[model samples]
Target: MASRSFKELSFVSIFFSTLATSYLFFPTVFANTHVISIISPLTLVVLDIQGDGFTAMEYVYSTVLFFATSIILFYVGITNFREERLFSEKPLTSRLADFVSAGVSRDHPHLSLFLLAGFTIPFVFMAQMLTLVLFFNIPMPLSLVLLTVSAAFIEEFAKSIGLYAVARERPGFLTPRNLLLAAVAIGSGFLVGEKLLLFATLAQITESIFGSVLFLSLQVLWMPLLLHITGVLITGGFLLLWGRQGYGPGLIAACTVHSLYNLHFLMGALL
Candidate 1:
C-alpha cells in the first residue's frame, strides 16, 4: 500500500512537472504570436532599409530565438544534472584507453591522422553529393549543404575527443555508452541553439500550428541525434587510436566538421 501510494505520488509529480515544463519552457506559441504581432512593423522597417535592414533584423531575431531555444535545453540539462555523474564513476586501470587518449608518449601521430581521414572521407562523399546537387541546381536544399556534409567526415572522428577529455579528467567514462551520452549532452546544447534559430524564423514566417509543432519536434530529435552521434564517432575514434593521447586532435577534428556543416550553407549564400 505504501509503495502504491508512492507510485501515485510520483506519477502526479511527473505529470505536473511536465505540465510546468510545457508552460515555462515552451516558446513555440509565444514566439509565433510575437512574430505575427511584430511582422507588419518589421516589414515596414525592411522596406525602408531593404537588405541591410533585413540582415540586421535577422541578427537580432536569431539572437532572440537562440536565447529562447536554449532555455528549454538548459532546463533539461539542469534537471538531468545527476546523469553527468556517469562520467565520474569507475575503476582506474580500466581507463588505460583514457590515459592514452590524454596523450601518453606511447601514442602515434599518424594514427590520429588516419582517424581524421576515415571519419571525414565518408562525409566527403556526402558533400560530393551536395556539391553535385548544387552544380546541377537541383531544387533540393542538399546543394546548399555540401560543404557541411564534407566536414562530417572530420566531425565524427572528433567525438572521440569528448571521451578522451572526460577520460583524462576521470577515465572510467571511456565506455561506448557513456561516451555516447556525453556527445548527446553536448550536442543537445548545440541543438537548443539551433532550435531557437528555427523557432524565431518560424515565428516570423509561418502560422500553421500543426505543421510548426511537427517541424519543431522533428528538428529537435533528428538533428541532435545525428549530431551527437557524429561527435561520438570522431571523439570515440581518437580515444580508440590515441587512448591517453588527450583529445586535442579529436576536438580539432570535430570542430572542423562542425564548421564545415554550417559553412557549407554559408558558402552557397555567398556564391
Candidate 2:
C-alpha cells in the first residue's frame, strides 16, 4: 500500500512538473488565457500576473524554477522506473556507474550521425537559457568566465550524451577504430545542426562580435569542423581507454580544451 501510494504521488508530481517545464519552452500554449498563473516545480505558485511579459527578476526566477522542476521530473521518473523494475535491480547510482563505464556501442555510422545531429538543437536551447540567466544576473569578467566554462561544459556534455546512449545499447563498440568513427559521426552531426540553426534562426548574430566568437566563424570552412571533430575525439579517446571510469575525466579534459578555445576568441573580441 505504501509503495502504491508513493508511485501515485510520483506520477502526479512528474505530470505537473512536466507540464510546467513545457510551459517554459512554449508559453504560447496558454496565450488565449488572460489570467496568467506561474507555477514553479509544478506546485508552488510563484506569481499570478495579468501580463504577457515578465520582469527581469521574474524571468530569472522562472528559468531557475525551470531547471529545478526539470531535475525533479527526471529524478521522479527514474525512481519510478526503478520501482517498476523497468531498470535493473541495482541501485540507481550503481546503475548509473555501470552505464557510464559500459563503454560505447555500434550502429550504422550514417544513421548514428543523422540521429545525433538533431541533438544540437536542444543543447543550444539549454545553453541559451543558461547564458541569458548568467549574463542577466552576473556582472563583468566573472560573467564571462562563467559563460565560457558553462558553454564548454554544456556542449561537451551534450556530445557525451549521444556517445553514452550509443554505449548503452550497443556493446563492443568501444574499440579504437569504432571510437574514431563515432567521434567523426558526432562531430559531423553537431556541425550540420549548428550550421542549420545559424542559417535558419541566428543569421542576424553571425555578424556580431559575440556571434562570431560563439560560432567560431572562420573564412576557412574546415576550421570549425576540425575543431569540433578534434574536441569529441579527445573525449571519446578517454572513454575508449578508461572504460566506464573515463567519462568524468574525459569530459573535464574536453571542456578544458573547449574553454581555452572559447576564451581566446572572447578575449580577442573584448580587446
Among the numbered candidates, top lDDT falls to 2
Model 2, residue 44: distance off in Å is 24
* TM-score for all models, in order of appearance: 0.33, 0.62
**What's the residue-level lDDT of 254 in candidate 1?**
69
Model 1, range 1-271, lDDT digits (tens) per residue? Answer: 1112456558667865764344333332233334332222333344345443445565454344335435633543453344333253334333323333333222433333233223222222222222332223334345434334443443343334334544566555557665555555545543444354445454443344222321222333775457555866676657756776635677667667665545544544456
Residue pairs with clashing backbones, model 2: 101-244
Error of 2 at 169 (Å): 4.3
**Whole-model Cα lDDT per candidate?**
0.43, 0.56
Model 2 spans > 4 angstroms off? 1-110, 168-171, 204-213, 217-220
> For model 1, what is the C-alpha lDDT against the true structure?
0.43
